[model samples]
Target: MRPPDFEARMRAGECFHDVRMLPAAWAVLRLDGHGFTRFTGRRYEKPFDAAFHDQMIAAAGRLLERFQGLYAYTESDEISILLPRGWDLFDRELEKAASLSASLAGSVFSIACGEPVQFDSRVWLGARDEDVVDYFRWRQADATRCALNGWSYWTLRKAGRNAAEATAALHGKPVGFKHDLLRAHGIYFNDLPLWQRRGTGLYWERFAKEGFDPIRGVAVSTIRRRLKVDRELPMKREYGLLVGRLMDGAGSGDSRRTA
Candidate 1:
């Protein structure tokens, strides 16, 4: 009945429950909004909302700053953070990383939106740089697919189709069908903002800052790092290259449209 004996007995119950991220591999922490569909209804514009987008970006930025992530990507209701191979946050405890990150992101976004929100987080492991590149490419593809379906569905809804009707109309439709549906409504799918299709990316960049050297009575420039939010990300092979460069520590100064 001693306190130390009770503590040891309780610890034994968690022996196989806790998991850790592999130290030699890259860890991508992906946080997804829970129950956002019901939450966003009537509160945000259909398909997309600029204010909500900004809130997501704010949450992603906080994650990057707190964890020193190599890169961050957000689309729809989810954000994915890329942690370097050597990252040792929480001693690479998977549960700690996921729980704390989800809580932090939910808190940051809730404060920004003036309403409580929740995100569920998970850790993805990549064994190599190419694996990392492929993972992002996959996510970008999912973004574009979701964008297309969203526009198509919203177009129908605005044109008098009910929720069930809109869902049924595009349920078994092909990609071409969705594209044509949007085009018929005077919305060109390809011409839509790149961020809608490819998702937004955030990474650190170094830039020169000018300041007065008061002690020496002279103006001096120094290098500083800032988190760059990219809205217009590249596609396909180019997108892969961007991820590769980021993993290799050459992401700064890459050309892209920003918000």
Candidate 2:
């Protein structure tokens, strides 16, 4: 409908903003909910909600299946997805990867919750395996801290304090103080559910299934794989080791598929 040079002019103007991740580097896409504080306040329970947790796991599964991600970890309203070093989706374009990841996750969660929601995403580049391990470890630590704070804040609010008063009660308080505050209310932070403290992990696991082949008239076996959702995640070095094993297993599967 326009002149012949119209398309060329538009392309030239937008081309400079195209940026890509470095080749051969691992990519971790972290998606965080936008305005979820107000959104979830009326629709879900505080501290932890089982229905919301299930929705998050379902959304994580969708991301893993759609993006070929190696793993996905979710805590609260944020999800972090791991991609292999060799992945080249969307030619590693930064804008494309970030936008699509956010949109996909947001759509899945919104549909499951029966409400409109939005998520924003950012990519983390890991130059080596250790970097990837550290990235997850850091996020897990954040989850623990947030879990503690959330329980404490809500406990004070339920007792009689308003939102601002409850927040001020925790400001500048050390971790131990927060724990003691909950202890005073008869809640042991360590005794809470594992998923509440450590976040949830989703990945693929393989198994062998035996079947009878009618055409061949014999018993046969084949490998099968499916998505696994882990709510009771470990801590510290143990979690790093678990993630390392998952990465190794994914690499082995890739090799077999190519061969």
Candidate 3:
């Protein structure tokens, strides 16, 4: 969460243990092509990465203030979000966000990519508002998996591998993608998550054995690991926004966990 007024929330002394159940949450994924690397390589080669970067940042700021949720922008290709419970019109809001992202990105890289764009496709994962913080922590892992899958295949293709060859390499990996689709002007999955830093995912647990419900001990460990993520996830900004909203009632000693 961003700089929160924990002291003020705690001063009220409301108990979080027995608070009423929170509403369901909706996930919104924002996808975009990366930067200006491809354009520079071929044509003018103007060191315009900085200019494009600023465009993205400004567009992000404009978009965030206009929407609601656990919002965050990835420097690379996507923004992952969460809508709090009670936001009855959440799905509609999500579509609006998608359109807005596409419009903004298109304008920013119009000359280079030759098109304004956001994600080619998107996915959604639902969660409860109360578990929102942990949800993102889990999602970053999943998103890392998603972005890595796409990037790895793209790398293979760029290195002279074909569709068949790239697909084979990404099998059993985190997030899978086709190499040809990602070879646009500037974005690659690897560039965003820096997969090299995280290494190939280990699949710490597979859902099949227990399905939606996990074994108690393992669940605790997973939650603990997610809650303690020192690294930033795509939803941190929105997480802060929601937490700040909830602080209205939660005491300083409320259930909110400080990072």
TM-score of each: 0.93, 0.93, 0.39
Worst 10 residues of 2 by lDDT: 250-259
Per residue, candidate 3 scores C-alpha lDDT tens digits across 201-250 of 11011121222324433322111211111123224466445444432322
Please provide, for model 1 over 151-177, each residue's C-alpha lDDT reduced to its tens digit, 9 standing for 90 to 100. Answer: 999999999999999999999999999
Clashing pairs in 1: none
lDDT score for residue 124 of model 3? 57
Q: In model 3, what lDDT does residue 259 have?
A: 22
Give the CA lDDT, 0 to 100, for residue 152 in model 2: 95
- Among these predictions, the greatest lDDT belongs to 1
Give the local distance difference test score of model 1: 0.90
lDDT of each: 0.90, 0.88, 0.43
Candidate 3 weakest lDDT stretch, 10 residues: 199-208
